[model samples]
Target chain A: MKTVAGIDIGNSTTEVCIGAFDDRGKLNFLSSASTRTTGTKGTPDNVRGIRTALEAAVQKTGTPRVYPEILLLNEAAPVIGDTAMETITETIIMESSMIGHNPSTPAGVGQAVGEIIGIEHLSQAIQGRDYIVTVPERISYEAAAELLNAVQGMVSVTGAILQRDEAVLVYNRLRRKIPILDEVAKLSQIPEHKQAAVEVALPGQTIHMLSNPYGIATLLNLDAEETRQVMPIAKSLIGKRSAVVIKTPGGNVRENVLPAGEIYISGDSEQTVSIDAGAESIMAAVHEAGTVRDIAGQENSNVGHMLRRIKGGMKNVSGQAESSIRITDILAVDTLAPVQISGALAGETCMEKAVGVAAMVKTSQLPMREIADRLQAELGIEVRVAGVEAVMASMGAMTTPGTKLPLAILDMGGGSTDAALVTEEGRVAVTHQAGAGELVTMLIQTELGLHSRITAERIKRYPLAKVESLFHIRLESGEIRFFEEPLSPRFFGSVVLLEPEEMVRIEEDLTLEQIVDVRRGAKKKVFITNALRALEIVAPEHNLRRVPNVVLVGGSAEDFEIPEMLLEELANYRVLCGRGNIRRTEGPRNAVATGLVMSWWSE
Target chain B: MQTNKPAVHLYTVDETLPAIREICAGMEEEGVPWKILRMDGTARGLAYRAATDSVLESGIGLTAGEVALQMRKVAEDRPLFVFADPTAEQYRMIGANAARAVKKKRFVTVQAG
Candidate 1:
């Protein structure tokens, strides 16, 4: 008999299968064994573990006499990590206190007047006859109050047109309880002689007047054309809280204001400045800087302020003498609110966080080459690492006996899942994904809070049976049956007493059902998700609906339930899924090794 | 039929096409009914195509061993030939012989012209 050895090095374990070919060229399974893979399974450092597994299989098979005619070698499929990093930065500039004037028509020009809450306005009267104007979305209620207070007058603050939930908090802090409108959608532009009320809509709710045309027309006293013109404003109030409208003569008119050129800076600065000097512009500039300064000065600020402080705090490292600093970039926004500025330094500090994240995801391929060299030096063997997908395809073809043609294979490993499609045209395509069995283990560990990975793996692999009564356990192959075996103390109440000697334990505290649920859910989220993604990416031009049969291999396929799970998952596409026949014919776990031997044919 | 005494031979060339021609000429002189197969568009296009198709129709019935013999004949000139591709139905026919030759160190020399 001519003996051939097949070896598979996996992330968690190394498997070996020894098969012998008779004189008639018929292949027969001899022996198979598995051992824990040491070091990195995907690296050349794993040769020691592979050697151990091969030795064990050889010992079990007792094929020493035939070793001369037999082949002894392991297949090397290198593991390389691929990662992608992306950074998205968005900046929004705001102008403060200035009215965004769109003067296509004149009745919309007047400033909105409302009662001052925390601060008085400049146009305050003894009787407090102020025009109840709507506030734009850009300005917060607190800033509105501050703007009014700085105007220097005994203005009775009643309500404001605010942007966010902080409106209620600002209102709560007022000395007097006034009618507050939270979401005023279009506060900057109000129609004339239109008696409209501002109302702050609750979260997840749209303002009544804004959603309905009739409501807006009734509140604003608009005719057909005017109502039609203001319909968009009504639509914009779909999710606002407070709004304000004024009763003006000659109907409402919209105005357009040209924006001045924007200022772009690449350094640090002390205060906000504007190219065109005007009361509104100056007020907006001051408001932007003042608000930022106050927040920075406060004991506890919001996340935005905290981020700014963190950036600013890193200005002078190592006590180097402080040099000239300028604002990095300034973007101008066409709003009455203050502009927001973002700064970045010239050195590594500016991009340190982003670079760190990118580095973590970008696992380099350099280590793989080094590992290959090391393995060659340690063991007198040539190790060539390749994508798992390629290896799976080769193995799939070898294991499927008498099946002549192009076939695809999917190898689901612990850390990654790979698939390779070989076409009848002799072309091959392969793809690899990051999440697989490891993710399932993670889910099981997290859900059960199991401290040990071994325990988690056990839960993932086996089914549970409760021992109703103590009984004997029997095995047909080994003829090693036991009776009247003493049960462990831990299996007392929860276990079903099967027999006097043997007790069947049902996992009550941590059951396989829970593990299956978590495992399947995680697989759906990771493997299945990645599978579809990889398939689409690999077969971009090919119609996936018409793809051929797929064979499954690897340790994951050894699980009794995994095949069924995959079959059900892939049922929609009418794809065929089954365990590789390698084990039945040549012993399981030798598919790759067999393929390695067979690879000599194609080389 | 009477035959002359057999003799072993080895030929090398700097380029792929010339090496392929020299090997083909040697095979013809040796009276070996061999075929050549090309995978994809690599190597000498005209020669590889002509060799592969002729061998397929060589009346030897598409067997892996037969294909390997053809490949071995061609390999005397072109070193690189794909014999086993899982996706192809004819992989088995060519793969068996190529594998044997590779093991015996009789396959085409990769770096030798």
Candidate 2:
């Protein structure tokens, strides 16, 4: 009988499994440990993390540190993942456009259109001519209402614009109630004398007229072609409580088409594909090129910058010369990037089509043997390099009681998605592809224009809810949650990430539906796409239908929804798919590490 | 004279007791000098007093629920502006002012809800 330790070093974490081989010839599972990986996978710096994980496992199991008969380490692959995004579309306003930014407190309901005029000038204005008063902050709501009341019949005040949160107050005091719009942060930017339309929907309702382009056209007297041009502007203002559209001569909306540039794929033959062809065509071109050796973006275009950034990252991780690193696979997903409208008074954003790419680069073979030697020397235990990571993972996956032979395992980690198939005869086939958890995070941050990876990560991990009222929040699924005490005022009008312990506020003014859409879409794009791609490569005859059972084992398999998403995707093929329960107790994690000990036991 | 000198005071109607308690507790922890002044008039009447009363200048007053349009009309320069008890939706409607006050912990100084 002998005691053994299995250590698996991954992109994001290091895991360890401890066990003792009984005289009965079964490896008895003992304890396991995990810690954040100290450095890039397949690098010598990983030894520090491996040692820490082993120490934890040994301490937990109360096994003598020097008692391990041997230590087994996974022969981690040399694949590296890098992600990038480029905007393909942008909204350009040719002239000063209307402000539709929803102020939390717009006053009154209903639509009104009239020429813009200052509140102070209301009393002196032409009689019987309709006007929308633009009230500056210096004028108190009472004073503005009093002035409007004095000229109520003499000068027609059809509507009012306010620069402060006193919309309700000012609206209540009006002798002749007109639709009032408030919280116009840039009140100074509203061009005076221009025809403006104000629309405020009642509580629990949305403004339909101002949110429509034709509505703005009718108010401003625009022709058919002009109305067509305002659709993008109108689309962005949808679902707001209030909106403002001003008429500016020669005002136009344009779509800014950014140059996506060319991508060079060097496989058996060198071929170039333009990213402008979209994701489908570009992928087709990549498939046609065959046995991809490397991919590079054009010299100065966005794709070029993206590829350079990837190569730079690989160089940093491997300490390899730039020339030795080559991107082996590229997974490109078509995505829409929301770019904020420049100079918009209300925060308006327009969707632009773009490609989100996760590239896998191959470096010079990693010296895992050197790492194993150093770890063995430090721990005073004989250490041996184990089978390929995919094979070890498949072995660990089989420990799940109900699993059978002819099974496939999907190992989705932070940087890559890998799959392996093991037959009853013990023949193993494996494949590694780019795009996983990290890629999903990149897409979320890029598509939402969050600008903060930390915030994007939180959004990816948590559910979302819109703070509709102090006592209640409407979740993405339309379920309402009520709080005993009032929630913090800062989270009052914004979507918040619902964490287990507390509600984390997302700084962006996005709706719960919009944020959830970005997050779920990103997960589907990366994990769902990569899962199918990796399985196809490892399946017999490259046909997934032949693979009967698929068990997920890795860090990403523990994601709240990824396993379910994969099961739904694989159901069409009638393939059994679920997260692995290694040893009937240990979760999807530590699979490769556990498998290492099993391999030695069989030997 | 020193005792008679006007300091930033917190005045609230009976309806805003819950919010006032929290604000006072926070203020106490920060070591800021504060006094609770009781209002004995209507919401609108309080605003008029804040605007004209010399000793009441630059203080804050908490109203019952929503700030009437009348209070906003007169509270522009009154340090004794009435602060209404803000619902989540109404607080968001007020926007930047509420955001700043909440972030800066100047909860007592926020304008009428």
What TM-score against the true fold does each predicted structure earn?
A: 0.39, 0.81
The candidate that wins on TM-score is 2
- Where does candidate 1 stray beyond 4 Å? A1-6, A17-32, A42-44, A61-63, A68-393, A401-404, A467-486, A495-516, A539-542, A586-588, B1-113
| RMSD of each candidate relative to the true structure | 36.1, 8.9
Q: Put down candidate 2 lDDT per residue, A1-603, tens digits, no spaces.
A: 888999988889999998888888777888899999997787778989988888888888863454567889998877878777767777776556677756655667788888889987765688667788899988877788888888877887788989866776676677788888877777877787878788888877888887788788887788998888788768767877788877777665567778777899988888888786778887887788888888988988877887788788778766779999988888888988877777766556667788878878778766788899998888788999987788888888989879999899999988789888898898988777888888899888888889799998888788888776446788877899988765665565677888999998888656667787788889998898888888888888989898879999998898888899999999988889999999898889888998888998677
Q: What does the i-RMS of model 2 come to?
A: 14.6
Across A244-357, the per-residue lDDT of candidate 1 in tens digits comes to 443334333222222222221122234534323332453254334521212111223222232233223222211222131112111111112111112110000111000000
Q: Looking at candidate 1, what is the lDDT of residue A603?
A: 37
